[model samples]
Target: MNVDELILVSIDDHVVEPADMFKNHLPANLADQAPHVETDASGVDRWIYQGRVTGVSGLNAVVTWPPEEWAKDPAGFAEMRPAVYDIHDRVRDMDRNGILASMCFPTFAGFSAGHLNHFKDPLTVIMIQAYNDWHIDEWAGTYPGRFIPLALLPTWDPQLMVAEIRRVAAKGCRAVTMPELPHLEGLPSYHDITYWGPVFAALSETGLVMCLHIGTGFGALKLAPDAPIDNLIILA
Candidate 1:
């Protein structure tokens, strides 16, 4: 194929977050400990039901698409249809589009780290662990070179944060994204915290790239009443 005929890849696209049933595939004991594994007000039990993460509080509930449909076409109706957190389908879609490779981000995982009021340190650590494992084992593992998994770290806990980074890197993840907002109490930005120095050094050493995507937890911006929303949009 000519250069123009070659497909281009879009790294940094999103896959849906796990639903309440995400733990269903886990061992009974371990799955029981998974958060948000309950029924919703409508009494649905499945994880991807109605595109919401039931049994959990916070913003980790948005659904992208179902796994079956996603397996059929990933980029086609991502905006119009629901999506599953399946990485295999994502790779298939890339292949169908003639894309060579792509990087994937967690849709609901990033939202959890972004919302300050909903996610506490312990919960953040747990969810991050579950999400990372799912990404590496379920997503990247199946696709190998075709997919690059972006690790989600708990910015709230420095020690666990660094350890998680190391663990994911050992599993072949080379990029991680933390919310631009401070997910923990008392710390300013991730750059301002002294404890994060070790984490940063480790990342630099391992050639891991730390990405900051804007989210809700970054703290509130004080906008003057006279300022136009356009300015805020532009800054964003």
Candidate 2:
């Protein structure tokens, strides 16, 4: 056999979160305040709600889109035929490409979290927990050994961070992604956050890697008023 026949593995693939997540998980009172937007024939619901916070009002509105919209659809838009968002399609692609295993990160859910700064801390934490559970139950459990899940910790609270780490680990996650920059004001960088030492140590002991993925770092930057797309490309 050729050595080149060895299987490959991708450590950082992403899956689009299903759109109904917020509709299903948000408290009934809050969910009522959000309006559902139309999705494709998938019957998936997208919702939006304005943020009450200042300085970020434009960025404060949250939008949810169906995961299928992120997938390849031959009958749909020509530009949307990549099929990366569907787990089954992704697995087939991986098999054809000689990939034996893959780890999936959240796409839409994490993107939503970026705009949810105005939400109360408890609600934010609840959202993270719900997303983590949904990923495990709906994604990883579906494929067993073929798909490894990555958890997202509540970076705003160190104690909860440690608890969530253990909880998700027990649910079969092998890695976790935390904000590369502090998510909360007054919190230090990852390297300097003393309260997070135990969390990091626990991850080390468990052989789980703490991933600092893009769009997850903390810092200020300057960008042209009309150059958001170019800025994103350059940053990516």
Candidate 3:
């Protein structure tokens, strides 16, 4: 088979979320607390939530950069191609690559939303649902079958996670991203039946897949912070 004839479906692509994701989704009361991007004096953009920076790296969206330019991540969204955040452009990019469909994980939201655990309760759940709405209702919904809907769960609370699983499944989400090692994130481990039982049950009942992505529960390999990222990719 020729390379040009081989169609592809990427299950692990990612989206550099748009800046106004929470703008129309969140309620007026939570607007002030919703996550937003702020650019520092150096013009480096970071996701800030409730007065704290989420500390997400830009490497997640560096694919659009030239090979030599990928050594370091783009400092801000301004440095990325519109396809990194725009669904319309993303579909076109997929077409160019012969990708029939793609499932995009969240970016600043953390692979499994562990970064959101620092925030308070209902607010965290709210933010997650809002993100899901943008991802499911707008992002994937806009292009129909061209994309797979992947939702983020508030894993800090198992009950909340179950509710979110059901909610997003109703919204047409086929899967939810979860931390590979919940215990490392200060949550109960998979062995803790009491903690994960209901959550697992909810996922099974709703028929939504639970996607445990690497590096979500902390880095998969214990490499130094300054180590070359290529090492992790090659080794992983």
Candidate 4:
């Protein structure tokens, strides 16, 4: 093949995340507490995780809507693209756009289960594993090479985190979404290699990459402490 004909790859792609992701993957005993799809009192469809509302509504599906509407306003499933959650539809869109592969990070699950930190432990850990299972088995396993499965683990305890990393590493996950600014999120600093030695070692042995997306630890960009998100987004 000619160099000009090389396939384009999107290393930082993301998933809108279907509402039933955790529900379908979690154990029956814990499934009810998992995230689920529900329409808010305002009639907006959203993913409710442990009773907390999450995600950017239809932001991930903007391409499926009229350029004028979704770019500014929140939208529901009906108003957005089915391809955002459906793997088959996503592949078609990638084909149309000439993308051969994508490494999709999580939406509501945070940059790499960072959102799970807001909840309590134990169950929080379970949910992270659930999301990883769903990502690997259903997402990547379903479509093969079209998408890369990015897993997230419980990062509160270094020991448990290492174990979880090894567990997923054995499952063929090539990359794991991580928090770049852990200290900002009330966790240890990235310089604390003493606690992170095991993490790096496992990743090195398994050949897994630490993929950190923006806003995983905290706000990625905030021009003003109290400024409106709009100002920061536009100005930044």
Winning candidate number (TM-score): 3
Model 2's TM-score against the true structure: 0.67
The alpha-carbon lDDT assigned to residue 73 of candidate 3 equals 45
Task: Give the CA lDDT, 0 to 100, for residue 154 in model 4.
Answer: 80
Off by over 4 Å in 3: 55-57, 71-74, 217-220, 224-226
Per-prediction TM-score, please?
0.66, 0.67, 0.93, 0.86
lDDT of 1 at 68: 30
Per-residue alpha-carbon lDDT of candidate 4 for residues 27-93, written as tens digits (9 for 90 to 100): 7888777777777787777666777777544345566455445343446777657777778888988
Error of 4 at 178 (Å): 0.6
Worst 10 residues of 1 by lDDT: 69-78
RMSD of 2: 7.3
- Comparing candidate 1 with candidate 3, which one achieves the higher lDDT? 3
Better of 1 and 3 by TM-score: 3
| Model 2 agreement with the true structure over 63-92: per-residue lDDT tens digits | 133433322121221123243445676677
lDDT of 3 by residue, 129-214 (tens): 89999999889999899888999888877788888888888888999998888877877889999989999999999999888877
Candidate 2's C-alpha runs over 4 A off are: 1-6, 21-79, 111-118, 183-186, 217-236
* TM-score result, candidate 3: 0.93
